[model samples]
Target: MSHFSGIWIPIITPFDGGAIDHGALHGLVRQYVEAGVSGFVALGTTGEPAALNEQEQGAVLDTILSAAAGLPVVAGVGGNHVESVLERISLLNHKPIAGILVAAPYYVRPAQVGIVDYFKAVADQSRVPVILYDIPARTGVHLELDTLLELAGHERIVAVKDCGGSLDKSLSLILDGRLQVLCGEDLDMFGALCAGAHGAISASAHLMPERFVAMAKALEEGRLSTARQLWHSLVPIVHAAFAEPNPGPIKAALSQCGRIRNELRAPMTAASDDLAARWTLILNKVVGSPAGLEQS
Candidate 1:
């Protein structure tokens, strides 16, 4: 479970001239790793894995693995198609991926049993540990707490990315004492940590990994005053990145910080100019100290 905690950034795969910007991707990993993110998530929603082809995904994976220099890389292998997800994981069996993160089926909206079995099948076959992704809004179904508990100790099911939009779920997991809980909601990050969550896996970290890590570490160290100040400062930034859908505000924030050229694939647009400018104000004026990764 320790392998899965802390401020982990669901990295945004940079695009330039209609191609995966490996150079920018490399820079982001380096920056975040230096900034103190415990791990990196490639091809997640922020990375726009849906828009990338298999070859492009493979290439981005290779680039990220190479750039990461040994930080844990959780490949975004989850989707509605279980078979294809399994195939993708099989293809990645040899890669040095820390784990696979798969969301439950969307649109089809399977029963809890089906969702349980779906992840169990993936976990059963995965070469690495698995983090069940419980994003009810995105998946169109919740990773019911009982269902998750049933799957909690299953083979390779070591951790959870619990963004069910509630600290109650996170608290329940910690109380259950079966699985480690990592809060996936930026808005509720401190509350989750306060509720005994181990750490956060937030998209906002992509904008200010240093600040996010700092807030987590402060909370961990019992410095509530400092943590509160930082957390308040962070709310606006988090709000900005999520204003136009994830990775939009984040990518724009990163670009404002000069980390990358803000670009996105088709079907996923970048933030409007107004939002981008607003993100700059939030990042520069509000968040002063960068969140450090090592302490967290």
Candidate 2:
């Protein structure tokens, strides 16, 4: 029943020759839309928002919104500065986004109560729904169980992108039933879904989105045997996608498929030659397999 309940791509911001490749970005969104992704998360971690300036981020989101053709888009808003984050949320409120994904303040490592206050403030400011992004690995501040439960009381804070890396905590959130849980860790997608997570925001799904959508649908429909087969088949590609610090291997695979150029910004390089080769071989096997070709 939740609109967030399915495979959502935290889309990569494609680049070509040191510029934001709007054409490639548009094409990627169209490709995933056709692939039956539930929606997209523009400017999320995968999109490299930290590398782009305000103008570039806005342009990228505009292109994705246009290409989405009415599919829901959740814009990513993150920062340690409360006022700045709220300002970003206010700006996004004018856009046609389904929600905002707000991560905990990074580098500051605020206390749990501070985390609660921050999200509460963000939820209060956001006109659109808010999906809490609980990626402690990146933020260095974990959204402890009690903090999350407290935040769930906010009407606007509708869901969580669960990347806390604690299965017990993730399961607890699902069992609580107040906030919809979307698996943010690609490798745990299956287990999370089996535990009743609403869906996933997968980076690897950029490669075989339809397959991911199918797996989610199968699980939702109670087709356990089919979902198991799909998950088993996807494990290798998932591993390959995250093999080299995100977006690199993902960009390489997309480039190999002729979707986008294998380019990344400064500080984030392209996938290594060896990793690219391995990715090609793995992609070939997966895409060529009957499971990959099967329609949902």
Candidate 3:
């Protein structure tokens, strides 16, 4: 079966003492695995891949792989330099990961053709299946529909993390059905699933993962009402997740749950006090009462 389906957490990298806290990282992985996440996306945007050096990134991936406890894990490999990315993939090729999640080259904003060639090069070199990440907002270029459909034809390019921001294109890909579509945008997950996208690789799942799992299961099981109810409840928390930059708000929420420290690397500050207060309030309402946060 395709390993990319269902609610997968692009886990936040826990920090303590200005380093990647492996202890906190392990605990977080175990928490998600027990919470019933389908798998994990290590070193993805939510994990702050840009903030971590290469050695730190590898260590983080290794830690997550060890703690995943048999759950499938996909590693994120992204950058504007093809050679550098290829070297990274070459190293990752030796790992026991399920797949690699790669994005279009950032900043350079390559053309659609360049985008296609870039992904093709990565897929050609990657030993595992490739899950294309189409987050143009960060990557600075969109993988046009033709580019995506073309990439789908490649045997190694098995799926896509759909964050290109076009409902029409998203629906087209779903209808084409060659590539499995996993929603990358937290807020769009329910709608994408309703439109027949396979599942989600959600950062927001780091908080209340079971709820996300239940919601996805409900949709697939044809329980529309149950899915809607769950989606509505999750909407507020999803808003809070992206309220600041990413990882910051998510780290804050996780900290409140005692899953990780409420810290982030340089240039990425902690969530504002106001945002934290708001998150606490929303978390309580959606997750449970005041006592539940402490207990959870």
Candidate 4:
């Protein structure tokens, strides 16, 4: 079975008074596991990994793995330096993780060839499967179709978190049939899944995850009506989740439900009051009284 196939939450790192909230983080993993999410992407972009020091990141991953009980967990490995990323991957290879999510070198904006080489080197060094995170909006470089195709040939480079923002390229990757394509964009998930994407690594799945899982399962089982209904119900929450910058709106919604405190690292503030109020209204309408967000 493909490890990447299903709704996986790129979980947010909850904080309490500026400290790593391991208790809340553990609670989240248990909550999602009960929600039936396929797995998790610990320390992914949504987790505010950049704000976490190495020690904090390691501790966060440890809490997630322990709380996940046996579900697969993919650790996020991101950096502009190849050697540093490789070193991190080397360490993660020892952990009981399912795979590593690596993005293109950010800030430097390396050429496609350099991008190809960087991934190849990382894939070679890693013992676990690598999921290419092609989020160009954050990284400032697109993982072009040809470059993606070339990387698909790597045995260890197994899948892609498709955030490249090109439908044609995304569709092409699906058709190629080499690398499993997992939709990274929350809004495009339904279309991508209908077009044959294996699953999604969704940040918004942090809230009301069971619906997301059900939606994915419905589509996979050829129940279009069921999937469409869930998608329509989910659209408002999805839109609101990203209304502000990520993790903020998401954390706010989670906080209101008492899942975690509505706190974020410096430079990444909590969702605005207007957005949070909108989230409450939408949650009430969509899921009925924020019951889904209540502690498990």
Candidate 5:
């Protein structure tokens, strides 16, 4: 199996009123690839897959896969409906995607056995490799380590984006040559690295790809202190992006840098004015000269 290491970005989709903005999406893809990103995760949590219609998901997958060139594209969202999820797997199987990033069912709250069966069913049908997504904080259900180990033994199950936010649980899975764990939390990145994770599926890389890449390299090279310092500098940005709903602070920062417009779908709102202002202040404190900030 091919390796998936380094900084993989969970990209946020750019939308122009319920429709995928191909231009903006393509531009972001090119920009990220140029910025030294190792892989692309289109339609993941950051991409707002829940908000996207099937047609939009297909379109974004096509555009992102084509734009990503040879870099790996992890087409996201296997959705909740088992039938729908299987259908998504079929579609992704035919695409140029390197793997499928499947999050747990939101609001359904299935049992552990159900969770295991859900992935097994999808993996049985999936043509490409499957990267199990375990972001319990978001999905309200955690794919227990035993379930993951069982699924990892499957023929097509390849890797995972471990967002459970538990280093202990993540570590347990990685011990004894289990699944390859890609640290899923932004703030705990350095810690995850210390705990033996392969790499990260980081959302912050959308804003600072090259730097995140450098940190990964630094850690790989045994420059622990250097990597920690770089990781520390990003805490403010991380805190800000998460202070509000995700892509909100990120979109605001992206717009401030001119990557995308500060627009979000309903049920998802923009950052409060006071929060936006705080993000600006935080950016100024860390960014110094808008060096990494995008401008129109």
Candidate 6:
């Protein structure tokens, strides 16, 4: 089966004047592709899928797929409603996507058994493979190791985006060698890669995708020193991206580079003046360098 195993950028949906900015979105996708990222994840958490209406979400994904230029794109399929989520997956199955990234049911925090059942059912109906998204911080429930092991038995349940925040669980999954373990925690990406993770589904990679790709390559080639150097430099930028609830800081940094307008939907405003200022310097240091990545 095809498995994802490199730096994948979960793109933030760029907005302008309360509408999806297709022009900017396409530009962002083309930029990342040229930067040598392994793949792309559209409508993921960082994309602010929650803020987008159903039609808008479909349009955004369509734009991303078109702009990706045949690169692998994983569509995020997640929701608390099982029937609705299944229907969504069914529709997505017809799309020319690499896989579907599904998170555990959020807010409801279903029991472990229910979690397993939910994934199995989704996997059963999905025409494409499934990349389990285990981000408990947003989902409010852990897809515990046991549950994952059970799901790993399924043919279509191929890989995982490990963001549950349990080091022990992460190590166990990596050691199991059944499911391809892709780190979802940006800050822990270097460590996870060192521990044999397949790759990362990184939001921060949206900034300097080549650096993230180079770091993954370094680790794969057993160039620990080189990977460590890249990781150290990326630490601050990753931290800054999350300083104000996600895409805000990311958009702010992108705006400074004239990539996007740094706008977000209601209830999710742009980054603070202070955080935007801080990201400017951080991005400047990371953007153009002898290390990796070109300034666009």
Top lDDT: which candidate number? 4
* Candidate number that wins on TM-score, 1 or 4: 4
Please name the candidate that would achieve the greatest TM-score relative to the true structure: 4
Tens digit of per-residue lDDT, candidate 2, span 1-296 = 23688999999998888899999899889888999999999999999999999999999999999999889999999998999999998899899899999999999999998999999999999899999999989999999999999998898998999999999999899999999999999999999999999999999998778888899999999999999999999999899999988889888888877777888997998999999889767876888732343321
- lDDT of candidate 6 over 1-296, digit per residue (tens): 97799999999999888889999999999999998998999999899999998999899999999999999999998888999999998889889999999999999999999999999999998999899999888889988899999999999988999998999999999999989999998999999999999999998887777778899999999999999998888898899988988888888888877778879997888999999778767766766532233354
* lDDT of candidate 5 over 83-134, digit per residue (tens): 9878778777778788888888877889999998888898899888888899
lDDT of 5: 0.81
The alpha-carbon deviation from the true structure for residue 138 of candidate 1, after best TM-score superposition, in angstroms, is 1.1
Residue-level lDDT of model 3, residues 216-293, one tens digit each, is 999999999999999888898899899999989999888887777899998899999999999879977776853465
Error of 6 at 285 (Å): 2.8
lDDT of 4 by residue, 1-296 (tens): 24589999999999999999999999889989999999899999899999999999999999999999899999999999888988999899899999999999999999999999999999999888999999999999999999999999999999999999999999999999889999999999999999999999998888789899999999999999999999999998889989999889999999888888999998999999999899889878876777655843
Clashing pairs in 2: none
| Predictions in order: lDDT | 0.81, 0.90, 0.90, 0.92, 0.81, 0.89
Question: Where does model 1 exceed 4 Å of error?
Answer: 287-296
RMSD of each: 3.0, 2.3, 1.3, 1.1, 1.8, 2.0
Which 10-residue window of candidate 3 scores lowest in summed lDDT? Answer: 287-296
User: Candidate 3 or 4, higher TM-score?
Assistant: 4
| Count of backbone collisions in candidate 5 | 1
TM-score of each: 0.93, 0.96, 0.97, 0.98, 0.94, 0.96
C-alpha lDDT (0 to 100) for residue 219 of candidate 5: 93
